[model samples]
Target: MKNYTVVAKDSFTVLGIGTELRSDYTDYAGITKEKADFWESIKQDGRLETLKAVATNNYIFAVNEAVNNKMMHYAGVMTEASVPEASRLIQFPKGEYLVVKGEAQTAEELSNKLTGIAFGQVLSEVKDVAYVGGPNATVEMGQQNGILFGEMWIPVVRK
Candidate 1:
């Protein structure tokens, strides 16, 4: 079973790169690979380390939103500092969120697992405790230690 927690969070901002993604399940693999490639490029160019240095928190968030049936996926760090060139900034409003935590062997695995739990499990389970309709944001948080950990943050409102 997946372990999760419900918590309240304050408003925060993140700055990083992103790409448009389709919500169709068939496109999942391609989008996951694309995001992985982006992270790899950032690491090779030393941009990942730079963002980490000024990051307010250790969590690297993969934020997503649905627009016109397509998804906008953003891989970024939460920080108030000025981001490097080409990075877009997104602000997350304060709200209650359902947080699911887990560890994976690779970024691909983490992405798949988190997505499954967020949409498949959390969405179904949350109906009894909270209402998740409206404009809710989903975030996949990266690991902090040596382990490849991931956390899914789903914004919700108590029923």
Candidate 2:
């Protein structure tokens, strides 16, 4: 899967990747609060190890994660200076994306299906895809009961 460059919309997305502290995310509720800390700690202490674990395709993208309805507020530790009001959420880069399409029953169901299917199944069959969209950013398919469609987007190093 050779990477292609295309402009992407700027928006918010919940990035869920990297080795989960609690495998299976059985403790999903505890994940987010520790996410920033985990990222920062690695960024500071183990720069080289962090770089080796995986490659980063930093690009602007929009995806929806089902609001777990559980609020994990960080007291807005990020001040107004860091992020302007116009852009409430921040994405890594200006543009470019790798997209995947999927249809399923629920957002969660769809997400699960995509994770298991799009990446887990498809990539295994197509090894080059690893060189393209390195990792995906999950998006909650539009609101629907019992079923929905989700399109996963990843930042690929543009060809």
Residue range 90-141, candidate 2, lDDT tens digits = 2434355555666676434455555555555554454333424222454543
What's the TM-score of each model vs. the native?
Answer: 0.76, 0.40
Please list the C-alpha lDDT of all candidates, in the order they appear.
0.68, 0.40
lDDT of 1 by residue, 62-122 (tens): 7776645756766677777865543567766698877787788766577668777777777
TM-score of candidate 1 to 2 decimals: 0.76
Best by lDDT: 1
Q: Estimate candidate 1's RMSD in Å.
A: 3.3
lDDT of 2: 0.40
Looking at model 2, which ten-residue stretch has the lowest summed lDDT?
71-80
Q: Say which candidate scores most in TM-score.
A: 1
**Regions of candidate 1 where Cα sits further than 4 Å from its true position:** 22-26, 67-70, 129-145
